[model samples]
Target: MSGAGNDAAAPPLAGIRVLDLTRLLPGPVATMQLADMGADVLKIEDPGAGDYARAMGPVRAEVSQFFVAVNRGKRFLRLDLKDQAQREQLLALVDDADVLVESFRPGVMAKLGLGWDVLRRRKPTLVMCAISGYGQDGPFAQLAGHDINYIGYAGMLANNAGPDGTPALPNLQVGDLLGGAQSALQGILAALLAVKMGGPGRFVDISMSDAVLAHNIMPLVAVNNGAEAAPARDLLTGGVPCYNVYRTADARFMAVGALELKFWQLCCDVLQRPDLKARHWQLGQQVGGADALAVKAELDAIFAGRSLAQWTETFAASDCCVTPILTSAEALRHPLFQARRMVSQERHPTEGVYWAVAHPIKFET
Candidate 1:
C-alpha cells in the first residue's frame, strides 16, 4: 500500500486494490491471480449462500473445491446489491478502490443502480470490468449460460471435442476459467495503465463468448479455410502418435508431445528405435494421415514397454518430450513443485491447516 518503487518483497500489484463483485470461476480466478500478485482483493458475495459455486458438488467437508481453488488470499464481505442501502455501501466501497470486476448478466448492474457509468462518476479513476456470457448489447446478451454454453455458442466447443464424431462434453470449465479470467485480468492491467497515463479509469466489457472465440482463433482460421466442423479429428488433437497420451504397461499413461521434428527424433532415439523416423514418419499434409497414426502407434508401443515408474526413472532427465500423466495428488507431490514451494499447508480460518496451492510466485529485493 506504499510507494511501488521502495518495496521488493511486496508483490507487483501491492498497492492495487480490487473490488471483486463477481462470483464463480471467471472473475474469481482473475482476482485470485491478482491476490497472488499482492493486490488487496475484497470479494463481495451475497449474504446467504455466498458464491453459487460454494454449493457445487465437489466439496472439502462442505466447502466446494471450485470455491477453494479460486477464492484464496482475499477477504470476504457479504453484501446484497438488491437492498438500496447495501448497494450504496458497495458504491462507497468502490469509491476509492483501484479496480472493480463484476460478472453479472449484461444489464443486471444498471438495474441495481450500480452500473459502471454511475460508478465512474463517483470514482473517476476506478477501473470497472464487467464480465458477462455475451457482450452488453448482443442479441444473446441477456441469455443465461455457463462455460460450455459460451464455448459452444462461440463455435469452439462443438469442434474441439468428441471422439467418434459425437460431441463430447468438455470436462473442465476451460471457457470460463481460462477465457474469462485471462480477459478480465488483461483488462484490469490495461485499465491500471490507463489510470496511470492520464486521469479517468476505464470500463472493460469482457464477454465470455468473445473470449472463447478469441481462444479459438487458430482453429477458427482453419475453419474459415474450409476445414471440417469437428476439427479435433486433426493430428494435434489425438490422431498423431507423437502428440497423444498412451497407456503404459501398468495402465498409467504417458503423454508424448514431440510436435517438432527434432523432438520427435529425440523421442525415437531415446526409445532405442530408429524405425520411427522413417521417410513416412512425418504427419501427412492433408488433415490426419497414416504417418501420424504410425508414429502414434510406435510411440504407444514404446511407451507401453515399461511401467510408468520405470519410464519415469528412465527418462527423468532425457531430452525426449515424453512425460508421465499425473493425477492431481501425484502432481502435488512432485519434487520440482515441492522444491519451488508450489504446494504448502496454509491455515485457513475455517478449513484449518489444509493443503493449499501456494502462490507460484516470488519477489526479490
Candidate 2:
C-alpha cells in the first residue's frame, strides 16, 4: 500500500509537476501534503547551505529533522540562484512544471529574473503561488516576519498570548502550516481546476497575516462586534468549569468537557457530586459575579482522590465526559491516536526515529 497503486490510483496529483521554492515551515508543509498526494515535487534549495532548515539542529546526515518532516518525497535540487547559469536552468525547469510555490519576501524573485510574469510567459499553464508575511501591496507587505509575527499582526496571538502572566508562543508553526501553507495549497488546487476550465495558470497571492485573520474570524468578530466573537469569556474557552482541565489523585490531569446540561449532570452523577447537580451553563451565568469556589473545590477534591489511571478507566466505562492529559510522547502510544494513525514514526536519515503529525486528509482507500 505504501508503494504505487494499491486501491486508489497513485494519487490525484500524479500527473502534476511542482517546483517547490519555499523553505522553513509554511511553504514546506504545504508542499509536503502535495508530495504525499503523489505530485512530482522538485524542491529547489540553495547549493551553498542547501536549506537553512537542513542545518538547524537537531541535525542528521546534514539534514535537519525539521527539513525531513516537510521535504519528504521530493527530489532535492541544489541551485545557486545568484548564478546566472542556475537561474537559466531553473527557468527551464519551470517551463515543464505545472505549479511553482515560493515564500521569499516579495520582489526577491523578480530581482532574480525569475518573476511570475516571465515564468508564465514561458508556460501558459503554470500556477504560481506566492506566499508572504503580509501581501503584495500593503504597507507591511515588504516588512519581513515569521509565524509568530504574522500571528501577532492578525491578532490571534495577541488574544491567545497572555497579559495575565507570561506571553508564550502559541504552538509556533501551527499557524503558518494551517493559514499559509494549507491556504496556498487550496489556491493551487483551485487554479488547477481553472486550468481545466480553459484559463491559463493563475497567480495565487497568499498573505500569512491575512490568512491568520481568516483563521481567527470567529474570535475576531466577537472582539470587534460583540459577545459572539470574544473568547476566554466563552464557555469553551475558560468561562465554564464543564469545559476545562481537571486534575486527578496523581499529578496527572483529565479534561472535563460536559458542555450541555445533560452532559454536565452526567459528570456530576458519575463522580457522585450531587451537591453540584444544578450547576449548568445557564446557572453559571447567574453566578458570574459570585465566586463558584465551592463548586471548584468539590471537583478538585474529587479529581485529586483518584489516580489518573483510575479516572481514565472510569471515563472509558461511563460517559462522564473526561479523559487524561497525555504528554506528546505518551500521546503517540495512546490507543486512540494509534488506531487513527494520528502519529507516525519515520527513520529520519539524521534524527533516527522521528514522528510526523499525520495530515488530516483521509482517502477512500
Candidate 3:
C-alpha cells in the first residue's frame, strides 16, 4: 500500500512475484516484508481453515487483528492442496512466480506433491524458501516446536533470565521472528539476487533452531573460551552496573546502557556519584564479581530514590545511554517513532482505522 504506482517511484521489488503458502506468524511476516517492498505477493491458503491466525487472537470487526497485522498488501486465495485440481492450480501460479515461500514440516510438501524438487524441475529459475523448526533433514526435522521451544533448545532461554535466575518470557517472539522470518527473508533475497545474476535457482532451507543457535554469539564466545555462560551474569546481561536495568521509586524501570567508559563516566557524574566512576569494567573490575554487584546495588538504591520522571529530567541533557523503559502504548506516542514515520494508520474495510508499522528500511531516489 505504501509504494504501488509510478514506475519511477515503485519499490525495488515491484516486478517480483511471490507465492506464499505459509501461515501463522513467521512465514506470513516474511512475505509481508516482501509485500511492503512492493512485491506482488499472493497468499494461498487451504480452503477449509486458511490461516489459523485468523482465529487465534482478538477479532477486530470481522477478521483477527493478528491476521490483519501481518497480512497486509497481499492477494488471498483458497485452494486445498490435497485436492489434485487445487494442487495443479497452485503449480500454475508457481510457474509465473519468482519466489515460493512455505513453512510446512519438511516432508509435508513432498507428500502433497509440491516439493522443492518438483518445483525446481518445473521452473528452474524459481527460488524456493522452506522454513521449518529444525531443517529439511535433521534429527528434529519432524519435531513440533514453537518460539519458546526453539529458543530454549538453542541455549538462548538459559542466558535470558533475571536476578532470580528464572528465564523470563519475552513478549517478542525471538525464534519465530528472528530465526524464521528474518532468516527466510535474508535467504529469499540472496536467492533472488543469485537468480537475477543468471545462476541456477537456489533452495533456501531455514531452520529456526539453527538460526537461533547461530546468533547466540556472546554465549558461544564464552563456551569457546572454556567458560560457562552463567544466566543473568554475562556482561551484556544484568552482570554489570554500566549495562543493566534499575527500578525507580514508582516501580518503573530504566535501562542503562552506558557500556563505554566515557558514557559510564558521564552517567556517574549525572548521578552525582563521581566516586563510582573508578569502579568501571574497563578499569579491570571483574564483571558480575562481588565489587560489580556492590556497585549495582548502590546504583539501584540511588535510582529507587527518585521517580522515573525525576530521573528522566535529571538525565535529559546527558548522553549516557540511559532511558526510561516505555510500554508499547508509550512507544507509539514517543517522538522518536513519530519523527521517523515508523507508525501509520490505515482504515480496514470493516475494522475502521488501525495502526500499522512502516517498514524500517528507507531508500532515497
Candidate 4:
C-alpha cells in the first residue's frame, strides 16, 4: 500500500507506460526496474488478495517486507479480470499502454481473455512479455515451478555444491532474478527498441527454466569441448585453489578470486607460499586432482591461521583478490556499498522511516 517516487532528471523511459499484471517476485522486480528508470508502471493486482507477496516474508503492521522491498517506485491498482466491467476497464488501459508484463502459468491469461493474441490484435505496437516457469507451447509450459525447481532442472544447482557434495541452497533467488526478472527486462527493452525502430511489437516469452539453461554457458562450453563438465570439475567451480572460499581463524570466510597468474602469484606472496605459485591452473596440473586438492588444503590452513580482520588488513592494499565474506548486515554498512548508495532511507505509512534497497541502474544525462 506504500510507494516510492524517483526524482531523477529526464530518465530514458520517461514516457514509457507499463501495465504490470504480475503478483510475486519476478514480474514485480522487472517492473520495479522499469519504474526506477521513469516508466509509469501500473501494478495491477487482483481485487481479492492482491499480490500473494503481501503476506510473505517478515511483516510489520501486516506489510510484508518482501512486497515492500520490490514494489517501490510504481503505482498500484486492483482489478478483477474475470469481471466484465474490470476487463473492459483493463482493455481501455491497454489501448494506451506501451507494454504489458505478466507472470502466470501458461494459459492462465488466455483463459481470462487477456492473452497475447488478443492484446496484440488490440494494440499491435504494444510489447507484451509473459514470464513463466516454462515457455509458451512447451511440453512443460503449464507446469508450476519455483526458483529451486528451475535451477535444479537446468543443472545449475548440481554445479554449485558444498564440500559435502550436496547442492547448496542459495539464499539469492538465482533463477527468479536472472532467469525471470532479468530475462524479461532484456526482452522488454529489446522489444521497446524494435518498436522505436518502426518494427512491430513482439511477444516476449520468458521461461525461467529455459533462461537458466541458456545461462549455463560454462558447462555448455565444457560439454561442447568434449570435457566431463561434472560438478566441481571446471576451472571456475572449485577445481582450483585460486578461485575459492577459505575459512578464517574466527570461523568467518574469505573469498579468494586470484584467477590470473599475476593475482595468484600475489596471493601466494601474501600467504608466504611462493612454492605453490607454480601449481597454477594454467600450469597443466589437473583441475580437481590430488595436486589441486593438496594446494587447496595448504591454502585453507594458511587462511585459517588468520582471522578475517587480519586477512582484510593484510590484503587491504593488494590486488590479490582476497576479501572477507560479509554478512547482509556487514554488506549494508560496508564502505564500498556506502560509496555507491545501494540502500536509501524511505518512509512508510505505518513503519515510518525504513531502509529501501536502491536500484543499481545509474543513468547519465
Query: Please, what is the whole-model Cα lDDT of each candidate in the order they appear?
Result: 0.80, 0.79, 0.92, 0.89
List, residue by residue over 1-365, the lDDT tens digit for candidate 1: 22345553566898899999898789999999999888999999999998998877656576776688789889999998899999899988887699999998888888999887799889999999998888888788888888878888887766766566656776777678767898989988988988899968899999888888888765767678886534454656776666778889999998887766688777777788867665223644333565666666667777788999998788777777878889888888888789877897676656555667866556655
> How do all models score by TM-score?
0.90, 0.90, 0.97, 0.95
Worst lDDT window (10 residues) for model 3?
A: 1-10
lDDT of 4 by residue, 1-365 (tens): 11234444577888999999997899999999999888999999998889999989777876688888888988989999999899989999999999999998888888999988899899999999999997887799878889999999998898888656689889989899999999999999999999999999899999999999999988788778887445675788888999988999999999999998999999999888899999988887788888988999998899999899999999998988988999988888888988787876788987567778777877654
Off by over 4 Å in 1: 1-8, 58-62, 229-232, 279-287, 361-365
Which prediction has more favorable TM-score, 2 or 4? 4
Model 3 lDDT on a 0 to 1 scale: 0.92
Clashes of each: 1, 3, 0, 0
Score residue 68 of candidate 3 by CA lDDT.
93
lDDT of 2: 0.79
Over the stretch 1-365, how does candidate 3's per-residue lDDT look in tens digits? 33334436768899999999999999999999999898999999988878999988888777798999899989999999999999999999989999999999989999999998899999999999999999899799999999999999999998888867799998999999999999999999999999999999999999999999999999999899899656777799978899999999999999999999999999999999999999989999888898999999999999999999999988989999999999888888789998888887789998788888888887555
Task: Identify the runs in model 3 with alpha carbons over 4 angstroms from their true place.
Answer: 1-8
Candidate 1 lowest-lDDT run of ten: 278-287
- In candidate 4, what residue range of length 10 has the lowest lDDT sum? 1-10
* Model 4 spans with C-alpha error above 4 angstroms: 1-8
User: What ranking emerges by lDDT with the best candidate at the front?
Assistant: 3, 4, 1, 2
Model 4 alpha-carbon miss at residue 127, Å? 0.6
